[model samples]
Target: MKLLHYTYRKLSLLLLLLMAAWGVLFYYAIIDEVMDETDDTLENYSEILINNALMDPSVLETEGTLMSFYKFRPISEEEAEDYDEKYYDSTVYIESEDEDEPVRVLKTVFRMPDGQYYELELMISILERDDMVEAILWYLGALFLLFLICTSIGTRLILQSVFRPLQRLLDWLQQIQPGKELPVLDNPTKIREFQQLGEAAVDMGNRSYKAYEEQKQFIENASHELQTPLAIVRGKVELLAENESMTEQQLKELDEIYATLGRAVRLNKSLLLLSRIENGQYTETEDVSVDEVLDELLPDLMDIYEGKKIHLVRIKGEEPFVIRCNLSLTQILVSNLVKNSLVHNHAGGELYIETTSSSLIIKNSGEHPLDGEKLFRRFYRSIDGKKDSTGLGLAIARSIAISASLSLTYKWQEGMHLFLLVKESEKKS
Candidate 1:
């Protein structure tokens, strides 16, 4: 859930609980007031009855069947002396209605003329009060529901407006690519915290960009500076190998030194290529097809590896697997993957290359699973890796893939090492 929705849920739940509690309290409060009023009416009516009974005793006998029902019963003197007034809720049967009706009842003892004791009871209907309470309860529930709905919507809109700056900042951060200059951030807000956050982000981005440029420049200068000395040393080794006066042992040592120099030169070149790729030096790009690059490189590679008798399997989809990237980098990336497969394969091993509209897959026969985690690290060589292998091929390929918004991943399955390359867009889809 989004932060806005998450916060709104908690607020709405709190509001719901509070409104329910208050509504219940308000409802009972109204009922209590109504009950007090009813009791007051009964007390006033009882007082009038008692006064009339003292003045004229016949009123008691004749007034028993009134609309507000009442009754009188003769009692002993001792009972009257100890009698107390009582009020409660009850039901009574009316012969005319043929059913029982709810009533508010009051009972009291009184002294009549000639010192005679009599008991008096009074009742009043309260059906209307019960109906009114039910209606109020229903209305209160509906009001609470309506208010809750309105409050929820209002809170959502307000939260959206309030968090607009943060959302924009997140989007701007996403647009930032490594080695690329930061875009201008235009998120203006009055909130102090968000303003500070934006400033911090921009400051950090500027510092990071400055550091990246310095590192990229240093690598380029170092690689180019070392290249001339390395070439001169290799040349001196070649000349040393040409001495006719040298012993066989000396010649063998010269050849070993030359081979070591060649390996060093290759390592330096790979590192330069990898640094260039990561630094975004190859900005020029075009639509390039992986299968096309393979077709171009495969003929010479196959001839070179013909001694291995490696079986080749190529599965091409009807549509070519194409992506937008520097044409040179794309070629290098494809060459590295294909060459690594060939160079590492055993005699009479297999090479499988499959290209779909969105991805490229290369699998080569292997005895054991290579370390997928360390395979892409620079200078990561397997135990059985060839002595002449520079071990930077996959690393350079991975750098190119990242710069081009592509994913390069490795896995081992069924005695084969598999490399998969895919566009980030196609993966999301």
Candidate 2:
């Protein structure tokens, strides 16, 4: 979930809990206050009735009424001495409403002018107070609902506005590329924490860009510097080999030196190519078909390795297997993989190439499986090593595939070494 939504959900839950707690407390408080007021009204009516009975004892003979009811009964002296004023709630049958109605009742013991003791009961209706409480609850519920709705809308809008700068920062970060210049971040934020985060991100991008430039420059300079002396050394070795004064042993030594020099030159060139590919030097891209690449590469490869007597098997799907990548790098990637298969194959072995809409599978027959883990590492060679193999071919192929948003994986199955190159999207799916 987005941060704003997560925070809002938590806030909403907290608000709901608080509102519920407040509602419970307020409901009980209002009910208690209403009951207290009813009791006070009953007490006041009892006082008035007692005073009237003392003033004229004949008033006690009257019956109770609806709104205010009273009853007076004679009691023994002992009973009157033990009796005290008390209040309580009770239900009474109402002839008008034909239902039980709630009322507050007060009881007290008093002595008449004749010195005889009597018990008095006073009652007051609380039906109006119950209706008032219901109205209060309805009003409180409506207000709570309104407050919740307003808070939700206001919180969403406020959070969206507050996080706009972070969204802009994310957009800016998405556009950053390895070889491209760092983009200017224009998302201005007043929040101190977000401001610090934006500044740190910009600083990191600047440092990364600087490091990338320096690395690219170093690779180019080193390749250029090394190539010159290597060329001179090979030329001098060739010239020495042509001299007649060299004995048979010296001629063999010179031949070994020349072969070593040639290997060194090839290694240097391979390393330079790998560096250029990784540095994003081959950025020109187009929709290139793998089938077409194999068609052009196979004939030359077969001609070069004609002596191996390797059989070629091509499996083409109905739809073309096309990808968007640098044309030159695509050719190099295919060439290296195909060349590696041919170089490692035994005489009269088979080389299979399968192409589909989403992937390219290359399988070649070999005596044993290569290490899946180390096969793509630079300078990795098989146990049954070939002296002429530079071991950087598969590594370069993997690098090119990755840079072009493709997945290159190797597996050994059924005594055949397989290299599968598929689009990154297909791999994910």
Candidate 3:
């Protein structure tokens, strides 16, 4: 997958491992301390029971009387046995009067002034000790569980907030399109690393967009500066080929060279126009009618339409369709669409150009169908197996439309090819 995907997975894993290690250490440390404290309390209880039993002779016969002197009083006789089994390994006491005997494993001996000796012995069981340990463990486990729940929720919320801006930057980068302005990066990140990442992404996008602007400017300037020189060369070639000494074959070759140069000049001019449109060089915020420009370009299209027996018609709305746009660029857009229809139409075909308040619809009768999606792509030709057409017409028109914030579309319907330019209302001045 992607590096970002791998990085996110590794970060999540690291967090989980760290939390697990922390929980383990905390459980053992805290629970062990608690268990040790409980054991100390039990040891003190054992000593008090032993001292009280030796002090009162009656306590020796009845273990119940020993409860008042014990560190922790047994709740019941049954409980007392279980408690003794948990705490003592074995208990025995030698009478103080019998000072000669050694102190044994679980016994302490006491002797009275009357020469009477009392011995108290008891053994602790593993099961009762395990019960105290288990209690400590359950307390630790519950606390750890609460800590884990809080940390998990906090981690997700923190990560999402930290990565939110980066996600926006990623989405913006993915949506980069030629001839469009970069979108603004709005969300803020406070973490130093994430802030730096966001800054880098914004800088990269801005740099790329600036570079594209510079490249477009260069192409437009180069195309404009080269035009005069190219025309001069074509003129010189024509003048030379007209010399009487040149043979018919020589003149024919000269004519072919002139034709190729003419095509090159046309291509350069179209490319220059497209560059101008993308740069917004031709934009003007003045009211103009789309219908008026078509009136002017239709006559220019007539010469090409002649002898093809094709019909070119214009349908205008009763109300003037006014828009704030560059008249020169709009003319270029409309002219390209009309010329494309004329060039691709079948013999004796009909072409229609209509303008409404909100749109301009151009249609032509033609057998050449194209993938409507690909029609606006630069250098895409509608007709297959056709070598005579320059494929930049639609692309150029689209650039102009986009520069003016207009939407253009293409489709085939009812045996006729269609192109539409949907006008957007002008922004308030």
Candidate 4:
């Protein structure tokens, strides 16, 4: 979840728990105060009745008025010795009202003038008290609910406002690319920590871009510097091969040296191309059809590796796969992949090339699976790879694909090494 929602959820849960606890405590406190008031009223009423009954002996047995709700019972000395005053809630039925009335009851033991002990049971109606308590509970619940909702909404808004700066910084960071200039970050916040974070991010991006340029410049210059010398050495070795006085072993060694020198030259060129691609030096671009590039490269590659007798198979969709990329880079990318397959194939192996409107799949027959993880790393060659192979073909192909906004991936299927290339957008989609 996003940071805002995550924080909001936790805060709301804590608030709910705190409010529930507060509501419980407050509810009991109100109930306690109400009960105390009821008990006090009962105590006063009972005192008045006891005084009247002592003044007039018939008052206890009076049946004409509210006295019907009270009773006086004779008790023995033993019962009077253990008697205690009591107050509680109960209900009484009245035939005139046709309903039960809630009341507060008080019981006490009193001695009459005749030397007889009596127990007085007196009660007062509390129907209004019960209604007040019920009303308090309803309003209390409604108020708590309203308070929680208002606070939750207010808290969410505050959290969103508080985290706006961090969100802006994150958005700015996402738009910063390696070769492209970082976009302007216009986030203006009063917070000190967010300001520092934005400054740090911009500083890091500048330093990274500087380092990337320097690295690419070094690689390009080194590759260019090595080429002429490598060509000169090979030229001198070829001129030496013209001497007739040399023995068979001597010529054989010279050929081996020449072949090794050729691989070095190819490696230097591959590095130069890679450096150029990453530096965005090839600014010229066009809509290039992938199937067209494959068609042009396959003929020459097949002729060059004719001795292998590799069977070629092509599967094409009705619509052609096209991409927007530098023309030279596109050709190089296609050439490297097709050339690699031809050079690596064994005698009588198969080469399968399939194309769709958005993708290309090239599968070359192999004895076993290659290491998919390290297969694209520069100078990563299989154990039984051809001696003349430079090991930079697939690496160059992958680099070009990335530079052209495409994706190149590899897999092994059914004794074939499969290389797939597709536009980055289509691949992601």
In model 2, where is the ten-residue run with the lowest total lDDT?
124-133
TM-score of candidate 4 relative to the true fold: 0.82
- Alpha-carbon local distance difference test for all models: 0.89, 0.90, 0.69, 0.85
Show pairs that collide, candidate 4: none
Best by lDDT: 2
Best by TM-score: 1
Question: Per-residue CA lDDT of candidate 4, range 39-81, in tens?
Answer: 8877787777789889988887853244236778889989999
* RMSD to the hidden true structure, all candidates: 3.4, 4.5, 11.5, 3.9
In candidate 2 the C-alpha lDDT for residue 355 amounts to 97
Candidate 2 lDDT (Cα, whole model)? 0.90
Full candidate order by lDDT, most accurate first: 2, 1, 4, 3
In model 1, which residue pairs have backbone atoms overlapping below 3 Å? none
> 3 or 4, which is superior by lDDT?
4
Candidate 1 Cα errors over 4 Å, as ranges: 62-67, 74-87, 92-101, 108-120, 127-134, 175-177, 243-257
Q: Over the stretch 149-221, how does candidate 3's per-residue lDDT look in tens digits? A: 7765776667666667778768877877655677877757667886788788779878887888889878968
Total colliding residue pairs, candidate 4: 0
Candidate 2 residues 47-128, lDDT tens each?
A: 7888999998887897678878889999999998888789888989988889988888889988888999988888887765
